[model samples]
Target chain A: MSAHAHGTQHFDETKRANIKFSAEALTTIENLMKRYPEGKSKSALLPVLHVAQAESEGWLSAEVMDYVAELMGIQSIEVFEVASFYSMYNLRPIGKCQLEVCRTSSCWARGAEDVVDYISKKLNIKEGETTTDGMFTLKTVECLGSCGSAPMLQCGAEYHENLTEAKIDALIDRYRSEGTRKNYTDLNYTNSK
Target chain B: MSRKLLLTHDNVPNLHTIDVYRSKGGYASVEKALKKMTPEEIVEEVKKSGLRGRGGAGFPTGMKWSFLAKPEGVPRYLVCNADESEPGTFKDRYLMERNPHLLIEGMITSSFALGANTSYIYIRGEYFYVSRILETAIAEAYAKGWLGKNILGTGYNLDLYVQVGAGAYICGEETALLESLEGKRGNPRIKPPFPAIAGLYGCPTVVNNVETIAAVVPIVNDGGDEYAKIGIGRSTGTKLISASGNINKPGVYEIEMGVPVEEFIFSDQYCGGIANGKRMKACVPGGSSVPILPDYLVCKTATGEDRLMTYESLSDGGFATGSMLGSGGFIVYDEHQCVVRNTWNFSRFYHHESCGQCSPCREGTGWMERVLHRLEKGMGNMNDIDLLVELAKKIEGNTICPLGDAAAWPVAAAIKHFRHEFEYHVLYPEKVKDSKHGHKEPIMPVKPAPVMA
Candidate 1:
């Protein structure tokens, strides 16, 4: 039921510094582009937008998406079309820590509804609402393929599996104290092993 | 006891690394296919092996490969489908996480067989960390001259890359996957010119599930005939079953086909019997999209034959008393679990995931979810139950892709097998609201409902 950002606004060059990818992110996008054939850099748009969203506070604003379009040599509508289609892409602003709970059949069979309610009551916000202090955002996503460890929630890029009410409290406390921003691109990319 | 083709070395330490993997004969298939076997020979062996797609459709993998429309000078592609978003499935994740090189090796051999100089592993976006694991494994392969140009000095040059897709379940379909690979919305294209004829970038492409591709490693290591002899007829080779939802040992297990459903659930080596020593009520033997089966029907077919894990045995009754071995996502429900609520959950999932390309799926799924929401909330009348069934029947076989049928089967099956539960909510609205979603109460039987005309 949630709506994502559309490319109603034009790209702003002045805000480019705030939306630029890190050096490592830039290299990652460049290498991803090479995976396609010549004149097919548009294939890199999904991964490139992932890098852009990760660089800019964990969600895609209009300007950030436009910049990703420019970087990937695609049009702005191309970026918006992709960013809105997938549930993983957060179009609007989100809190510092986004808690996406798996609310599909297997997880629901093993008490996923209770987990959603517990997190909602604990965080004092609804399923799609952010907290007052911008510390947390609650969302119910489809399957994340961790059904073996059912009743799970994914925070940032990490999956907290076989979750319970007690685990939710501990995770919330950990994230609140850490007080740092997280994004999908926060992977340990340099791990050779 | 069945043989472990896929998970034979799942417990090995550092199996994810290239050195440990190579030490354990990981790339032997790649070497055998590249240096010794011709492309036609490898394809012939696969055809002889009888490996099927592990991504729920159960189509023959060899047949899929032979359909490649190889026009001269246009580069072919071999894309791995790692978008394991099916609700009860996570075996591909387990395989990719524990043994990344197995998949990489499988892709290399497959690419060589198809003469696809390029390959991509299109993984789901939520598995970003697993994507990193795959990326590291790919880098190791490139360094060892296993993936990039001139692989293993056999004149078979292939390049493999990992592409991540954002969260769309419909992208698991082959054409939809190709569309997603081209960085578009995950909408499926109409077939007839299948992905083999006009796939990614309008070239010939072969898309396979991660497990289906990984099986190539064993199919090539052992002879194709030897691989074909592992399981029952047609359903050859081993399968990765991801057991979840109220099962005692809810994890990924590799089993040769022909194992009985009863032994699979109760055997100590597998699911360790149902969780909490509870009585098994029902199961979706495949992923959530498959029709569900009651406990009595799950172990035996309508004709009293013991239901084996093979595809033919699983679908013995043709959605009346049997289900499919689709994607091998085994979800067991104990007596405490409620079918109506679980069906509602799945309906909500399908509603959320419909790509809005087809009218029946786009509207019917939303309608089913809304009607089921009312039924689960105890505010529905008898008409709502009939409406749910009507919507499911109308939605089935009315879309460009099988997602329409996938969305419809669960709802139709739930009504067919658990109509008493739906009627209970309708007749006892007050009691339904009093009991929460997790409240465990036996479903009381009522008079048989009239079958749809």
Candidate 2:
């Protein structure tokens, strides 16, 4: 058996035990964990955070980061450093749907400016600010890795590509409806149509 | 006609298995290098081949390996930079996904040459599935005694580890990756102490791209001199390009380095020309970070020679006319696509991904994203164009790492090639329509809810 050194005892184990990862989320974490060599479970920190962010509705609270730290056997500071470093891992709470608009070169050339404006105006929030109704939060991210489509956004895990003012509005409307109905299908499915 | 090398065994089914790989003469290089050749001889062979780093920079691979600090008793490390995060680049991902054993074989041979006992495959977080595949392959190698402790009974003890990053694009840089591997923030540390001298827990380290390391297997097996004869002068060997967007065949294709761009694009052997028979508007010859080249400039260089896919030919005029083969991400766009909107999206990516370690990149990226946002929305002014260019310039060489440059290059290049489009949007805001059809206008003056009292 491989001897594992669970980094530092940073978070309360009792509190961590109370906070459980969903079966799906745990499975995803386990899948990411398999990517590293034995005893290197710390390598899964980022992917686990991604799943946690999704499960917690687009933001990672302190408790959750700590919980993740405990689960990964890494320092809470290590998790904090990661969360604060990348723009994708949200450190604070966001609106129901986190609107991450790609403002990189390819997307800009394709008309991402209009998409940002439309989203900001529609949500009544500037970039990095959550909406008043808590329905949406607007943020400008780097590349979401879909440069071919260009002018894309990541609303939660789903990427909204080939965006326009009308598409941005429809996306907002769909999110609003999904929020109200609690019958949330994939946003990408709607965008594809 | 045939792939000849580089990707000859790519189409062979079950190539990922050790049995299939060895059947096709895999590990032949390891045997040759360990049994007959000296480490110095292997290095010389690679140097003679004129092989350069396939991961964008085009730095000579042998030169990189030679730079490894051989201080008296310290253990040097070998790291394969599998963090293929550049947009428009999916070649490495496919290479690993399809042929994981190739990478493993390369890693083992390279480790022996470098005198390094330990190696790590630093992969990007999004490559979850590919990483799993690699881990499985590593286990297979260890089982066969090709890895870990006296590999092939050569008395060369080696250990391999795979470290997955937290999805930061900057970590793709060697120094930043070293930091991430050490359980630190993924910010790029200052150089002078390059990873060659101090890296991976402050030890001498050699970091290489997935393809660069994988290419070593063939070089060592065939004798570097034979590999050197494959391509044109100083731009020797083949290159694997990930051709995507508005193309008939959007996948990874490996060809000789000196193949012409026109042939690569229009030839049935390569991309099979643009999709729907659409006219080509522009080409991002490299990855997203490269400058865009209009169709007219895509043909031959000023010397009237065909713009071959070699490093020298593609970057003939630098950013002024051509772009580098950075990571071989060849993205083609049709005339219908608007350049301004495309630039805006790229700006947003940089802004969001900036590690916030420096003032220029952190603030400048955000400002560029905002200005591009207004421009794409048709609320942009004439001065915003210059402002965008100025901001990009500020962030260009001012950041802690090349991430800033990666973020700025596309903006500077977009404005250089398509300033007129930006001006058009400013002059005629009413005529500028969103590319997505049938979408409605967003409500004006969106404001976030005030903090609770």
After superposing candidate 1 on the true structure, give the runs of residues whose Cα lies further than 4 Å from its correct spot. Answer: A1-19, A187-193, B434-438, B444-453
lDDT, candidate 1, A1-193, per-residue tens: 1223232355566775566667888777777787788988788878787877788777787788877877887788999999999888877778888999998878887888889999999988899888878888999899999998989999888899999888999999999999987677653353332
Per-residue lDDT tens digits for candidate 2, residues B116-148, read 887888887555556667877787888888887
Task: Give the CAPRI class of candidate 1.
Answer: medium
True contacts kept of each: 0.80, 0.24
Q: Which stretches of candidate 2 lie over 4 Å from their true place?
A: A1-14, A17-61, A67-75, A87-193, B436-453
**TM-score for chain B in model 1:** 0.97
Weakest lDDT window of 10 consecutive positions for candidate 2 chain A: A184-193
lDDT of each: 0.87, 0.75
TM-score of candidate 1's A chain against the true A chain: 0.86
